[model samples]
Target: MSQFIQLHLLTSYPPANLNRDDMGRPKTAKMGGVDRLRISSQSLKRAWRTSEMFKSAIDGHLGTRTKKLGIEIYKKFTEGKVAEKEAIEWAKSIAGVFGKLKGKDSGNADAAEEKETKKKKGKESDKNPLLTLEIEQLAHISPGEWDAVMDLVDKCISEKRAPKLEELELMRKPEKAVDIALFGRMLTKNSRDVSIVEFGEDAACQVSHAISVHPVVIEDDYFTAVDDLNKHEEDAGAAHIGERGFAAALFYTYICINKDLLIENLGDNKKLAAQTISALTETAIKVSPTGMQNSHASRAYASYVLAEKGEQQPRSLSVAFLKPIESRKYDDDSIAAIKKHQENMDKVYGSCADFRYSLNAITGEGTMKELLEFVTK
Candidate 1:
């Protein structure tokens, strides 16, 4: 068995009351003869994206001070990297695709209008028509869109473009560190209590990244930064603000503080890992359900990674999530979406097809709360 931290998070509204039958449909059961929370991982991740921390984190990764994505694109195009025709077409297409401006389709124009009216009667789309517009601009960059970016830049330079709510949205940064890239590596490894042979058991100073041989979990947030449903028409999104948000998966690097001593005793790794896990047991009480901010946890991680690291001196370990593309496709879906969401993800793997690392294929729902106590031998 491996000694590590296990975190359990779920959406507050999802009620955690989950039960599945033989066919995996909603069923009911009693543990203490009572119903418990049934939640989905997707839902849980959504909640975390909406937290304040995630928003701040997104701001941290991408600058939030400017609203020049359109402006930036425009500049790039004007500089002649992209043709003017293409840039405008991109802007028009993206606006059409993501915008809710569709009042009617030719086949059922009247019917469509009626349906739209009914929908608008309730909750309605954002009050501002521009909300969807901004979101669309942020979604894609084409030749025309690039010109729009230039236009935006021009506007901002002339103090024309104003920051909107959409500009505030941010995305999570998954590949800020090589070590976190490795954490996904260790998580996929099937061996339990398997001390990495690459890094010395007691090598503390060199430990750039680490992962719990067990589970590292986070609390669920109700608001998500990258949710498909949260897309807006006029939000202008991070693009309007010259900032961006992570609407994708994230990777983190961890370290064992008591590595040297644990290695010397061998048996001590469990205790140290357990204790350290305990300290991090407190899950995020507040996170955005919509904004999965990618804050560089390196600074904060330093404390957690080097926690209780000593004058007593001890060896440490570092691990990174295998570059997303480098890790084996635990399944087909992961491979498809993992890299598409983050373009840089593909670049990191380069031509190295050595992605043999495993992935923790969590099947059932419910937080593995008890795994927190799973001790290492």
Candidate 2:
């Protein structure tokens, strides 16, 4: 049997430009200089999203049901069952309150969205597993913050005329997002036993905080890592890398894959699976000639295609890291490196019949062998 493997699907985002000055050095006065990169959970998730692996991991869980989420909503909207005005209002009410609800309702938000589809689809949609709010993630906000935000949201829908989804999203700013309830809220569900900052300093935890506060900042270790949200697109430091908005946030939804089951299925095919895992992870991200996406060199440093997958395919779970490829900057050398890794993945997956991005999912849409049989429960 091959040893075990662990894939830690991860992403990093930066906070507002590190309060820089004309010289570009971090502005420092009283408290201390700010961090160079403000990594956030949203940014990390966006990075994770780019990976075919994350998509597959979750798809394996959702199976064909994955596609149904969006389809169900679209289908409902088209059916005229949900009033455009009402739906828009719902979105609006969701937005302002979303900031605080960001943690507690994160998981449920998904389910809530799914629930709407069921209402539209009727009983047919009821049986499938639907996306729910990721309370674990949302609970990161402070309880006071959470209650305040939710109250505000209730007023928006309960009182405010139909709200705009676009408008609502803006209300949920990340400024106070790191308050105890939102960052890692699930960690201190009891609340009574919690402290000022409940979590110990895990690298991921620190990285997520920086990203949440400043969505446009990237690490200095990478060239032009800055995507300053401060910029109006004209602003030199406008949102960069993980800091980019929802488009960036969308990528954070990667599923951690269990490797032990994979090797067991592989049997004599273990080597093939191992190589594919390495290659897919290798190409976890690709950097184009433009923007700061994944650089090939990152493959070596947990950079290009940072992988959390264990070296061996064990029942253990893991994730693959991906880098940005658009709207960011990367060096010429970095571009070349990513190409090689991507090519490696193409060949590896092409040869492996059982392995696929959706392998872990029960839906047939998932190509990953792990998911071919499961259905949304």
Candidate 3:
């Protein structure tokens, strides 16, 4: 089996905000001593994992990242014909196991005893409404673990009591979801209460932040929206007007996949591992993160991809742009630069991978079908 799969992709987006920074501008990073438009690895990973292509390729194997476990539990119990009040209590007990619960406990006699003790001193107040228990952070709970949690919640409600902390700890165990295996999870809040011994799974795939091959010059698109309801009065200029930052660049993307870790993450299922690699590569090639898609409509597929498979150590070819590849309208400067980097790597590392395949859109040639076969085989 191949130990590693490395992908080098060159994609171009024209005048769109594919990813944004805190200031709502296209994310940029300084690379090769020049400012280059950047799409974060986090953004890229999310777009691929949640893409329709990925969903279809690996159905029912994806995990959900959310903080609404309490709401889900509440809905499930109520749907099971449990009363709303009792359901909320049951949900709170289960949620508290994941994180600290705010407000007074609404469940058992221990809480009622405290309430009565406070009332004896005339200190109880009706101003506080019941607050639902919530996890401090969004948890990446797998489908199997969700089923387990639901079952435990059902058991708690059936017993007519709150869940014990030790029982809630069961939710933390890894359930071998594909996305969890690839992206991993990190739970810092209430880690002591869960069965998770580590902070998060070490990601088997490493994605570099996508950066423009050439220096980027930010452009501002100024525009206005007319009020459709307003009569076209001479004085009725516009309903809204805004300025947005946009850029066009040929981006360089690099990804290194550790096949061994990937298989382990998928519970030693070789078939699932192949499916994961296929889904990841396809999504990475096709999906652009939807940052301001409606506004800018920036969507594009990779112009070129070089897929390599081997048991050799993995390395990125991003050093090709260390001098900043010069791009032109009618020229293939970016592609040429990457090719030069690959040649240099071959000369230096003496064949970086066991096999290599190339796909180029400009030439309208190269085999994605064969590359996928190589990676999977």
Candidate 4:
């Protein structure tokens, strides 16, 4: 098996906002001394991980990433007909393991003297505490950890005792979920004694933020929505008018997978590791981030994909586009130039990679089966 697998993809998105910035405009980054439309690695990862293809391939192995974990725990306990108060307490306990929680029932004391006095007397304060409990940060929990927490809650309730802190701490070491293994998590402010291995394992995959191969000019599509209630012909003006940012460009995306790390993350399950890579690749090709998709529907697939398998140090072919692919008269497309540049650079750099496979849409060459076989084996 190869030590590393690298995928190089070129996909063209039409006018759409697959990723947005703080201003609600399409994201852009400066590359090659010019502005290029960008799709953040975060956006791409989430889209692929949550896509139907990924879910179908790795169902029950995905993690839930959210701060509303109290709700999940509460629901399970409540379904078992556990006392509402008891369930809330146990749920909060489990939630606390992931992060600090705040709520009316939470034992936290505020700075106010009156609240402190109320807490001292074991009395409720005049100000109502928040009904909902929330974690300080979003927690990524695997299904296995969730099950463990549920079982622990049941055991404690049956024993008619409050959960022990030591018991709750066990949840910190969850079975790694596929998405967590690939992207990893960092609990910088964790208050628990969980080891690095128990919390955020090192990410086995590195994804470069997808950037346009050429410079891009952001354009606005001014649109309006007409209200159906305005039936009269004299009601000519639209009900709402807004402008949205959009762009069209061929994007270059690169991703590298560390085989050994991935296997370790999956608890030494080599078969699951291969399935994960297959699912990830398929999702990347089939899924486009659904940002303003209802309006623009910018669905696209990779036009060209060059996959490499090697034991040598991994490298990206992005330098081929460092100068930005230019539009040429004889060869209008940048694919040829990008491919040529990669070949030339590899030759100059000792062709560090051991094996390579390619799939191009234009010539209808290269097989996905062969690519998958090479990467997995």
Best-fitting candidate, measured by lDDT?
3
* lDDT tens digits, residue span 1-377, model 1: 21222121111121111222354333222223333222233332334333344434433221121122433344444464445554433333223322222221223446767676646643332463222223311221223323443454344335433323232121122122111111111111112212211111122112221121222222332332453554577563443222321111222222232333333322333443334233222223233222122332211111111122123222222112222223433223332333342335336644222111112223332222333233121
Backbone N/Cα/C clashes per model: 85, 94, 0, 0
Give a tens-digit lDDT track for model 3, residues 1-377. 54999999999888898888887789999988999999999999999998898999999889888777878888878777787788877787676554444433334457668577546433322343233445546777778777878888778667766666667666654446788888776664433334323436767899999988889988888899988888976667888999888898889999999989989877788898899998898889899998889987888889899899888878888988888876465228877877888888889889888888888988987877876787788
What overall lDDT goes with each candidate model? 0.28, 0.30, 0.79, 0.78
Order of candidate numbers by TM-score, starting with the best? 4, 3, 2, 1
Summarize candidate 4's per-residue lDDT along 61-141 as a digit string, tens digits. 998888888777777777777887877777776776766554333343444764665465343222422234466567788
Using all chains and alpha carbons, the TM-scores for the candidates as numbered come to: 0.23, 0.23, 0.84, 0.86
Give residue 94's lDDT in candidate 3 (0 to 100): 71
Which segments of model 1 are wrong by more than 4 Å?
A: 1-34, 38-43, 52-94, 102-377
CA error at residue 172 for candidate 3, angstroms: 5.8
Q: State, as a TM-score between 0 and 1, how close model 3 is to the true structure.
A: 0.84
Q: Candidate 2's residue-wise lDDT over 229-328, tens digit each?
A: 4555556662344322111211221223334344333333344344434433333332111123332222211221222323333221111113333333
lDDT at 213 for candidate 1? 20
User: Best TM-score goes to which candidate?
Assistant: 4
Error of 2 at 55 (Å): 8.0
